[model samples]
Structure formats: C-alpha cells, structure tokens
Target: MAPKDPLLGTLKVCVLNLQSDGEMVTDTNPHLASCCELLELVLRKGLQQPVISLVHRDYWQCFEQLTHQDPCGRLSALSLAVEQTRVCRKLLSAQGRGRYLLRLALSRKALPQFITHLLHTPRVLEWYSPTTSILRNEEFVEPFMSLLLVLSHMEFKLNMENCSFLDESWLLPVCETYEVVPCREVGMALRYLSGRVFVLNLKPGSQAYVDKFICPW
Candidate 1:
C-alpha cells in the first residue's frame, strides 16, 4: 500500500513558494531536493494514485513559485505525469478493457500540457513525441496524438488524425517523402493513426492533410 501522507507537506510548501517567489526556484536551490523527491514519489506510484495528486498539488505550487526559471526542470516532472496518465490506461486495458472514451478523456487532458512544455524546447519534441517515424521507435500513440492536437490547435494545417492511419497504399506515399519503410511497423503505427481515421488534400500544392494532421512527409 502507498504511504498515507507520503511527502504531502513537502509538496505543498514547494507549490506555495512557487506561487509567491516564482523566480527563486530556477537555478539549483534547496527546494530542488524537495522537487526531486516529490517527482520520485509520483513516478513510482503514478499521478492518479493518491500520492500523485499530492505531488501534483506541490508541483503546481512550485511551478507558480518558479516563473523566472527556465522551465526546463519542470518538463521532466510534467513528462512523468503524462507517462503516469498513460500507465493508468495500460492498467485499465489489462483488466480486460472497456470503452476508449474514458481512456481518451484521461489521455486527452494530459497532452496539451506536455506539448506546451516541449514547445519551449523544440528538441524536447524529439525525445517526448517525435514526428519522424524513422527515428522514432516504439508505439507512443497517445503523446503523438496529443502532438497532433497541438499542431492542429496551432493551425499547422496538417491533420494528424487523418494522416495517422496512412494506408498500406498510402505507405507508398509516405515512403516517397520520408525515406522510411513503414511496412515493418504497420500494426503499431496504425494504432496511432486510428485517431485521424482518414486523409484529404488541402488543395493543389498546399500539402496533404490526413486526419487533420498536416505533415511535410
């Protein structure tokens, strides 16, 4: 069982400080210890787990406190939260699964935050949710879907949802641009693609839109 009050007070202090001070937490600080500790607790058990909310409350506290900081440190904590949310879905699925809407809601809520954080550090996109299929390994369907949402919200003109399911026939098209052979990863790729469901051409020479995800490839 999880600790009943695992690191709760510590997190609160951090959050409060963040809200009030904001700038002080950016560089190495005494509070970073607390921050790291809280992250450890959340990572081990998960964010939806009671301990996680406690950590989250504190994380927000710290975020409010550290407005002057570079925001880099906070990215790890946020990423962990996103991962934890994803884990909940895995657990739900393992228990013989139910409707995807519940999973979608939880999954859907976490992406925007993660996307915003990564936007500050463009390279972070490669590590957290990469667009290049050739460089990306493993099935990171939710984060990638979330990425599509961010791009859509940004009005990038690509339909991530539509392009997500690039048909085997479409695979030929995807390959011509990306230099990647998607055939090997069909099933996993399709899972990520399912959200968009189909594709459309925006207009002549405007770029192809699939599931509303606009991609150069």
Candidate 2:
C-alpha cells in the first residue's frame, strides 16, 4: 500500500515505476536514466530545503565519506564499493558517480546488501536528515526496502562499461539488453527450497563448527 503522506506517496510511485518499466533496467537506454532521475529527485527532495546549507550530495558522496571515516576497514565492503566508484576513470560528476554505483549494485544483485549495510552505519547515515530523507525516515524506509525486496526477483543486466557517458548525461547510445535465464543450479536450489531433500557436504577439523553443520541427522 502506498503511504498516505504526499511525499512518501510520490516516492512509492517512483519505486513502482522502476518495477513497471520492465524486467530489466540499463543506462544504455534513456528510460532507465529517467527513472533514476525520478528516484534521485525524491531522495534529494528532503535535503534541498534544509534549515542549514549543505554540499550538493549524492548517495555515493555518503559512501565516499564513510570510506574516510572508516580507516580501520571495519566496513570493507563499503570501502571497496567506494574505491571502485572513485577509481572508475569515466565518471567526473557526483551524479554520474552515484548512478554508476547504483547500477553496479543492481547488476551484481547486491543492492539489498548495500542498503542493509548503510542502515547499520550511523556515521554515514546521518547525512540524510530523518525528517526529509526516505532512507532515514522510519515511516518511509521499511516500505522502500520492501519494494526493493520485490525488485530482487528481477534480473538487472546493466553494462558498467557504458558508464563513460554518464558524466555528460544519463542518456546514451544503446549497447545491448538481455533477460538472463536463471541457470539450472538456481532452479535446483528453488526445488530444494520447495521441499526436495538434499544431502549436505561439510568439511571441517574443528573450531566449534564441526558439530554445527557436520552432525548426523
């Protein structure tokens, strides 16, 4: 159900558009870029008119800051994601950087992991004021994440190589698009989850782990 609040309602529409647009989203086409913009607008909508002035922020900018704040590498995944985006010789602008990382996460099927990771990192999460940002707001964040779980079923075949032009604009020449058919292994896993029996293979010497997954049943 869409939130009754007008702001959350608008965001829900954008999220639904992402699902309704098609089974796949790629920046090589402008339509996906348009959808990204709508999402971006909603994310920034709350931050745009703050009682205080702040730097023009993109989601990636938060990751960049998080990388600096976490020198110990406690959050190595965030650090690596930030580093990859930073070293991507193509993107020059923050907007392009954000889109690049977003698409990368989508294509890798790791967007949910990234979102959950961000929620746990308060030092970085504070950039978004709880009053305006959906990611920070309790009323809005859970629904947004639920919609993402719905998206988890769809395959995203974004071309990371096509990002060189993103610095200029989201629109770009078409490269290619494909709806990846799930491999047989995935199908087998689905069958197992559906109640098919399967044998387990566990190898271990010890570490308080031998009796855990290795015990007879």
Candidate 3:
C-alpha cells in the first residue's frame, strides 16, 4: 500500500484499524464496512461507461458478467463459491446484490480468490481503466491483490440471513458471532471443488463422505 495513492493510503489505514479490532470482523464492526466500501471503490474506479442505463458499475454485476464468460474456469469456480447468494430470492436491486455478494465473499474468506478470477478475465478486465482502477494498473494490481490475500486469512462472521433490506439500503447487517470450532464439529461440512461436492460428517473421527452422505437418524 503506497502512502501516495489516496485509495491505498485509506485502505492501509482501514486495515490497520482492523488489526486493533481483532481477527474476527462482523457487520457491526466499523472497519468492516469501511473496508467493504473501499473494496467497492476499487472495483468501480475508472469504470468503462456502460451503454445500458440500468447497468451501474458494481463489483457483483461485473463478476456475474464475468461468470457468464467463464474465463479459465475462474468464473465457474467462484460461481459455485457464491451460488448461495445467487439463489437469494430476496435481493432486488443490483446495489443490494452487490453488497450482499461482497459481504458473503468476505465471510467465506473467498474475496481474494474471486478477485484473482476476475483479473484473469481479459475481456472483463477492460471494463476497468488501468489509469483509474487499481485492479487494472499493472503496477498497483499486484499489491492490491496482495492486500486482498491478507484479508483472506482473517475471520469474517457476517449474518447471511439478514439480507431482507438489501434491496433498499446499504447498511451492513448484524454479524453473528459464534464460538470457534471446526466445521466438522457442526455435524455437516460442505466443500466444493471443480464442480464436485464433498460432505463431511460430524461424528468425531468420522471420515468425509463424498457426495453420498445420508442422515443416520
């Protein structure tokens, strides 16, 4: 993060603030909203003018379009990552959709992977100008990505069920905090890879069953 670049400078400050707030960030966390807004700014910066009036410069919209193109299976991979959000029937406006998707990505610690896929898409890459968008500039892009990688290691515990008002407001939802525990301890663990689903059973010492899990009840 360069001290000279305004976005980077602000972002560096926000991340520093996050460190003081601990590793687990919730929607109520002030720094969490700031960071998400900054990320939105990064994606929407110097965007190419759109011919469609309804089409605004939103990170999720761009990512969704990129998904349609499926560059290097990057879009496909992340499509699965966010499929839950995509099927969210509550989100009405693109703004809500974008915010929800962004938050979900952060919670899942998949923001870096999502951005990595977007960068690989040359066609969608042109939507952002190298001069204005950090994701486009060859020099800044690397550092920008590195910053996202840093975020990936942190824990985000956002409330996915609080998306009812997303279509109308930009407010961050109340993030729920839960005790630290392994996914397998919850009785079910889902892992998707290359379009394949792997299910983990909860019983201690139980082996992960591949797409063949059945309720023992």
Candidate 4:
C-alpha cells in the first residue's frame, strides 16, 4: 500500500513491546518502560501542538492506525501513557493549560474520541478516577461538559445507557450542577431523579452554556 507512517510504526513497537512482556511495564522490563516513556513524550508533545498540525501530519494517523489494529490493546497502552504522563491531572490543575488543551483537543475532533476511548473501555474505566470536581472548574467546565455530553450521545447510538462515563455518585452531582441532556436520536426518555428530569440534545455540539443553570426543583 503506502509507506508506513513513522509515528504509527513507533506506536506499534510500543504495543508489541508491552505484549511481549506479558505484564505491566514495570521496572523489571526496562525496554518496555523505555518504550512507554517515549510514547508518553510523543503524546505530550502532540497534545501541546496545534490540532491541525498534529492531525494533518502523523500523530492522529498513527493513533487511528493503532486503534484499528488493536482497539483494546492500543487503548490500554494509551491510557497507561496518559496516566504516566499525568497529562490530564496537569491540565486540570491549571486553568490556562486546561483550557488550552481542551480547546486544542476539541478543535481537532480528538477530545471526544479520547474521552470515549479512555472512559468507555471496561478495563480502563475500572481504575479511572472520575474526578467530578474537574467538571466544576471554571476553565474545564465547557470542554469537560461538552465531552461528557458527547459520550452520552455515543452511548445512545450504541443503544447503551446514557452517562455511562459517570457512576451514580458522580452523575448526581454533575446533573445537579449542570444540565445533561440525552441525545434525541435514540428516542431515550428523560431520566428523572427525585422529580428532577435530565435531558440531552441530539446535536453533537449543542451543549447548554457552561454558565447556564436550571432550577432542579
């Protein structure tokens, strides 16, 4: 077919390294650990750069390729890389950096996919800290809310329950603070909790304004 993408090749190598080890990349597996470190560096750099450049070049292509090749395995590696890099924690820690990364990820159509892949996978979500407070942060509210809403839509499309990303404890607080509407396309009825109804819009980008609030009563 076409020449192999270098980035994709690198990702495959990392994936293979992890597979060959047959265990988590621990200190014992120096080679696998090094590969993971390199992968993290590449991902962090890609996140910092412009979406257009990241996608039009090779990062997105590599990601997509790895995803298609081994959806579960590659995603595991990615989730581990993100965790090791602490990229999300760092971004959420700073208003400016969080906003910048959120905007950049959204602009490139990467955030939704990343969030879905990161949170939807059973293995990954098990250990994921669904930090609800991040949703309340001023800088993160819009992007985080939007991505959650998007995830709701994807689940609806798959005939799955809405808000699959959040557990009951996290969902209640978020729904209380923010209006989470389900996607209309699924014909899913509004879920009511204690007389409070939650609705989601079908349109992908049609999330309620971050500052807007509705009385739950």
Best candidate per lDDT, number? 3
List ranges where model 2 is wrong by over 4 Å: 1-24, 27-31, 48-55, 69-74, 175-217
Residue by residue across 35-152, what tens digits does model 1's lDDT show? Answer: 3344334322221223344332212322222233345556554545434433343222311111111122223443345434534543322332243321132343244333335322
| TM-scores of the models, in the order given | 0.21, 0.63, 0.71, 0.24
lDDT order of candidates, top first: 3, 2, 4, 1
Q: Report the lDDT tens digits of candidate 2 across residue range 133-217.
A: 7887777778767756655666777777777667666676555443333432211111143322343433344322333422322
TM-score of 3: 0.71
Q: Specify the poorest-scoring 10-residue window by lDDT in model 1.
A: 94-103
Error of 4 at 204 (Å): 69
lDDT of 3 by residue, 1-217 (tens): 5334578778878877887777588767778778878888888787787777865666677777767787466465578745666788877666777888888788878888888878877888888877777887777777788788878888888887877676665574443443433444444566776533455444545442232334332
Candidate maximizing TM-score: 3
**Model 4, span 21-105: residue lDDT tens:** 5543332344533443333333333232233653332233233333444444646544443343233332322222323333334
Going through the candidates in the order shown, the clash numbers are 25, 0, 0, 4
Q: List candidate 1 stretches off by more than 4 Å.
A: 1-4, 46-112, 115-217
